[model samples]
Target: MAKIVIREELKPKRVIALMSGTSCDSIDAGLCDVFPDLSCKLISGINYEYPEHIKSKIFQIFSGDATIKDICQINFAIGQCFSDACKVLISEFGKPDFISSHGQTIYHYPFDERIDNISLKSTLQIGESAVIAENTGCDVISNFREADIAAGGQGAPLVCFADEKWFHNKNIAIQNIGGMSNVTVVSDSCETFGFDTGPGNVLIDYCMQKFFNKPYDRDGKIGFSGKICDSFLDCLMQDEYYYKNPPKTTGREYFTKQYIENALKFAPQNPEDIIATLTALTAKTIASAYERFVYPNVGINEVVVGGGGAYNPFLMKLLRTYIPKHIELKKHEDYGISSNFKEVMAFAVLGYCTYYNIPNNLPSCTGAKHRVVLGKITKHV
Candidate 1:
């Protein structure tokens, strides 16, 4: 490789990041002022739900039934949503220096696939950068995962790049229980490693949508009303993904709607029990991950959780029960960041890193061959 030097005289700037995680529930925008010291102040955050029609189309495509034409259309369709979000966020919080769009992850296939002659691994997160750049009238950064995957990595659980910055001194575990749960163990020495722990809100939300006809378990009320089925919990515990080593990632592909349906059948046909069991499973899997990978090696003393699960009290209660007594559990907000907006904020930081030619993808966490600058930048001409 040829030598290339990045000028180190860049100034701190305001960045607006837009994200739609595996949940496919909504697009969230966060305006962040990122400083040289790696500190970020969230100027503002706004949430926008996808129109039911667009959401249905996206989900249908996710199910693998959509044609290539559908993928092409939704790629820009989602970008329009992101562009609109950026326009609104700029209006409310003033225009940022740049827009960092994490876009919508339609599919994340992390495993190795061998084709005709060679082995390949890829991950896709789509939101057309040109659309964002044109609509928002600013530079845009998107597709942050492809570089890591190109270097033979899982291309996921990428937030540790920002998590280690947040807890540089403490032996902390930052867990984001979004559609899928992922854990990042950041040590006092700045050694950070992470992986997908397993299913997070995805399963529980399925239970709620199926049984209660609600989008999610409000404060995990349904779970609180029911008792956990030990048998079902044990059955879930035996799943191979939990035992698989780190440097791994999973998505809706494995834990599909059918998986949830099958799990409910294994239980005693009570909606509450099913949800409670799913909640317990999420907590236990996280605790198991800590016990197996993090605790023995890093001696982590704190578990700071974020994502939608942070708002579910019963799920938090289950987490408290399953995690060790020596480790204190707290929400990301307890540390001065809003739980709902942290991911988008992290992307802002990642975008900042990319613009400055700084390496943002942590090899220790993503299992990449080496650290690399992430994100593809689209400059407005």
Candidate 2:
């Protein structure tokens, strides 16, 4: 190991932040100008699709069908995928001061599950930083969750740190409907907090593929065409994850294929109806989570929606229907933020904090015992 020096000056840094969310659809790479104040401006962004073969392997691991050798090999393999994504940005924008890679989260177990007296509150994100550093000839910061988990946090909904910094003073909920939905409540009345609201597009996307052989319900058209089964929606709303208090998180590990298959038993027979019901489930859970956790504590003035769900007009329509009429509904673009790359920009801020040795995790949101700088640096050398 080599001694690493933290940056002392408050200078702006150009960073290329790379990540692939729970969707595992594409590797999102964003080039940003991160300022000393931790504010970031996205200079450019790209969605680099994963090679079909590599993507299949990731799904295999998610389904618990892969061997240890497969996991070991895919770490570097996905690192190469991330590096390739960075190269696309680097070719046009040039090499950044450093690269921040969130890698790909294969599994996140922020639970109280114990094994042989060992608390298994852990997470695993696989793209190898050393491979990225070596291939790109640039310093890389990866594994942003371990430190927070070490501090007794759930190691998730981490975007709240950036949400607090970016939307401070505004009484709003930055709701991201990614593969799974999560919200960061930035308010003036109470401390910033957030958690996974519930399933986002995961179930809908799965059902779309299973029923229509499509990747997702574009503009939520399929969902709009069908009627929502309220009986089934009620059953889904009773999911235990929605009832759990905040400072919590979940991923595909909990909402696995098996879980989805079991859920389908209660679903409507029509595929479109199932899709519509699942979309409503996403919207309803988000609204219900707020009614339970946020509305009581914070007087939210607006709900700014982002991620793939924002593009789903039907989902947005359902959200508007379920959420209170008094509160305004807006998109990330309204605030000059890219819905697709906002998470990428958030990691850019986290990496910048790491470079300057600043504590980046928000304790209130993650339930960490304290603040901690959240990434590991892999130097190009």
Candidate 3:
């Protein structure tokens, strides 16, 4: 261990942010120049595929088939994967001031489930920061969720902080459709807030792999070919998660393989229809969330779609169909943001705040009692 000095002067810092969303698709690494004012510009990025063996173990954990030893070993394994991803960027862009790693979330239990009379609300993101630091030779800031949860927050939808920084004063909703969809409502009238809107590509991706033997619904072609089963969509919309109030969040923990299989019992005979209905469920839940939580509170002038879903024409079409026609629908690219690497860039900003000792979590969005700086710093020796 070494004494890590925090830069005292406010200036631009080049940071590389690494993350692998619940999709478990790839490790997304982005190089960004975070300015003193909190604005960040993406310099470069890469989607590094996980080694087949490592990826299988991750999926095993998701399926609840992995043991404690597997989880323990995979932490460093994934850290090495992250460090390798950073090396790719570092080789081309050079070493950044530091690296920001979101790691991979193995389990996120945000509920206040009481056990032995003690409320348990916790999250685990596993790429060991020390491993990342040692491998990259750069100070690393990781585990961005723990502090927020400790502060009585759900420990998610952290992008809202960056959304507020970038889209404030404008009545807009930044809807990110990733493994799971979430939205941040930035308005001229009220404090910025956001919540998980429901399934994004999670169910659809699962069904694609299970039935079609594909990784995902690329460009949503399969989804486009099928008709949405309204009856099934109705059933999915009834989920309690959809009805829950804001400052809420969810992930693979709730939408597990068992949950999907159970829902499939009521699904249409046609697998494509099942995919279509799941896709529609995503669009409908997002629109429903807006209708229930957002529209009544603040007027939105635009809705910006980002993440992997932005590339899915079918999902985007459904979103456009369900969202109000009057409100403009745009992608992150339209605003000069990289749709694939937006979250990567976001973590860069979060890490910048951490390095500067600035509070990064949006209490209004995450339901923390107050503002607290997120992330733990691991200094490179």
Candidate 4:
């Protein structure tokens, strides 16, 4: 392990942010320079796909009923993967002041009751930061969820920090369509609000893999080629998950294989129609959530999209139909932030914030009782 001191001449600072998303497909790494206060500049980013076996194992614990020991072992292995990705990032982009790794979340269930003083609510993110620090010789800040939990917050949509720093405007809906979809209401006063809207690419990917033998409907081609089943769409729209208010968060746990099975019971016999229906389900649910909760309150003028879902033209088109003429629907790329790499950029910023002892979680978004500094530090000592 190596410890590197910050040069006095560097005013703000720099860090590499790494995130392995819910999809378990790969690791996203981004290098960024940040001002001491909170400004950010993206330097470089790349995605590294996991080996097939590791991918399978990740899906196993995440989707399966793995025990505690199973999870602990996987955490260390995932950490090594994180460290390897950091190595690749530093080799190309050079060193940064610190590293923030979002690690990989295997399960997220925010709703739980209390036993004694502690709430049973919990979320799990694998990938040990210490391994990352030891292997990369860079200080690492990670486990961004604990502080939010301590504050009684949901510990989600941490990307809102990136939204505030890079995309904030008086009248924009910063929509990030990741494995899940979340939107941030950005206004001039810094009083921002965001939450996981619903399923983003997660359901789409699940449907495509189960039926079409594909990872995802690339560019939403299959969805474009298929016709929507109105009945299926209607049934999906009625799901209680859609009606839940803000401060809510969900994951593969809620939208499980069981839920899909139930939805499929009424789906059209044709798998293509089912795919179209699921894609429509995602787009409509997202748009509906925005129109219902965000538009009236914030009076949105722009919808800045990010995450892998931004690549789906069909989803984008569907989103446009629900928004207003006064509002703009576009990708983060249009705002100089690559949609695919934005989350990576966020984790980098979070790492820098954590290292400087800056508080990063927003109480409004996570419903936590108060603001708290997020993450644990791992030293290369």
Candidate 5:
């Protein structure tokens, strides 16, 4: 057996944080050592892409109208994936003290309005944490969003607490572009507000899968080689969702195949041109959001880009053109944290907080009533 040393403070406490992102790409597993009082040190992080067949089933089931039984079954099935991924990590790095799984967010509707006294506000993150805990022989914390929503918040942009703790600077906007693009403005005053800007890779990914038969546009090769279509850009910009005020959140639900089809209907364009315009759409929306909310409020001197979109050169170039030349543009990796792993590592940190009864949600980011400790715990026997 390989030699292993557990910190005296964390003698029997380890945590695994798992996430299946909106991109529908893979399962990201991060393992860490967390002490009794919520201090965490990441040990390892890895990703497990779903087999194509399984991925197809999940996408099909989650994308549109589906029977309630299918939804219930897939929840357990997603948990099994998390459990399997954790098992692999345990075999490679050792069992954990606990697990924090973000699960797969199938639906999240965070708004409630009423002319009378009736309103509906709910969010669902599927994947059975109890099942994962049972399978892994470790305590688990999952479904980390409901509490924030109940407090009258957007119940999203959850990555801000991690951003504040790990990457916040005096005058920088931390922009994370995953399936959706979101920005967190951190000022010298220490005030922060983060909301999803718009679709990140979701639109681009949809276009690629339709036109090229690939999951993603590999390093944006296709977009780089294409020209923007003005008509499509005009059509897509018409979405009222794009112009909505802050405290808003969206998902694959908003930027779906149907949405793309509608945009394409007004102005039919070639596939390559469509990709370019979509790529520009992400860049422009991100830049515009920062200019409006972040720069005006905090006066940004630098923009720190992160997440999967940080790797897209075409997107980066467009961002440069859109933002002021005086501001520096860079990736989060320059700060010693890998952009791709930051969110996965964040859940690990949250797991530590939940274990120690520390609050993880930032009220400024989520617009919650107050800073409340998030996540529901399922303990190991």
Candidate 6:
């Protein structure tokens, strides 16, 4: 690979952050100009959809039966996709200082499971950073959750560190509804923490693919068309994870096709009802998280929403209905950030922190033993 060198400057150089969440939908990437003051500018961003066959392979692994050979190979394939995303961004925005990738989260364990009398806790984020480094010829930082998990955390809600920077000097909840929903509560002191609230767009998108042969319920229209089945909604809400305390994380392993299959036994027969109920579940659980964990302590003034859920008019409407009127709810766009790009942008900042040896993981949010710099760097040379 021919490398293009960026001249070092006093200001933090531009960086490219690439991400593919558990949703397995598309690669979201951003070009950000990070500053020493900790503020950042999103110069540009793009969403690269995976080819049908590649997406099929992703779902294949999500089924949990893929052999090690499949995982080993697909990891590289996904890396190439990530690299391609960076290439596109570079072609448009020029070479960045480095690259940060929140690779595909194949699995994220919420709690320790015992085996051989030892608590086994782990998480996997494929798409090798070495591949990104080699392909982009820039330093690549990735595998952000491993260190936190090793330190006895749920290995999640890492964005809390960046959320602090995003809304400094405010008592706010930055709720991102990606494959899963998580809330980062930042106090006026700039002290920040968060955890997985509950399911987000992942469940709704899975239902869309399963029932309507669509990637997602565009604008949550299918969900809007159906009535929320109260009984079924209650049953779905019964999941203990929703009620669990903070420092928790989950993935498709806990809420996926098999999950829906089990729920179908008691769910209303109408697919749209099931979809609507799931949407309500997301809205309700997110609000419940804030009401239970956030509002009591900080009395939040704003709930800035981001990610795919922000685009779902019905999901936003349901969230609005559930949230208290005392707090203002706004989309990321209102703050001049693209809903889909915030997480990717955040990772770019994380990568910058890691490079400077700054501690990036927030112990309060991830339950880590202490603050530590997150992500491993792979050098191109």
What would the TM-scores of all predictions be?
A: 0.97, 0.98, 0.97, 0.94, 0.92, 0.95
How well does candidate 5 score on lDDT at residue 369? 81
lDDT (0 to 1) per candidate:
0.88, 0.93, 0.94, 0.81, 0.81, 0.86
Model 3, 1-381: lDDT tens digits are 134355598899999999999999999999999999889999998999999999999999999999999999999999999999999999998999999999999999999888897879999999999999999899999999999999889999899999999987799999999999999999989999999998889999999999999989999999999999989998888999998999899999999999999999899999999988999999999999999999999989799999999999999999999999999999999989999999999999999999988889999999998888899999986
lDDT of 6 at 107: 79
Number of the top lDDT candidate = 3
Off by over 4 Å in 1: 1-4
For residue 34, give model 1's deviation from the true position in Å: 0.9
Better of 1 and 2 by lDDT: 2
- In each prediction, how many residue pairs overlap at the backbone (N, C-alpha, C within less than 3 A)? 0, 0, 0, 3, 1, 0
Task: Pick out the ten consecutive residues of candidate 1 with the lowest summed lDDT.
Answer: 1-10
lDDT of 5: 0.81
Model 6 residue runs over 4 Å out of place are: 1-10
**Of models 2 and 6, which has the larger lDDT?**
2
Name model 3 segments beyond 4 Å from true: 1-7
lDDT of 5 by residue, 84-131 (tens): 989999998877777899998888776776547765666889889888
Kindly report which residue stretches of model 4 are placed more than 4 angstroms away from their true locations once superposed.
Answer: 1-10, 116-118
Evaluation by lDDT, superior candidate among 4 and 6: 6
Better of 2 and 4 by lDDT: 2
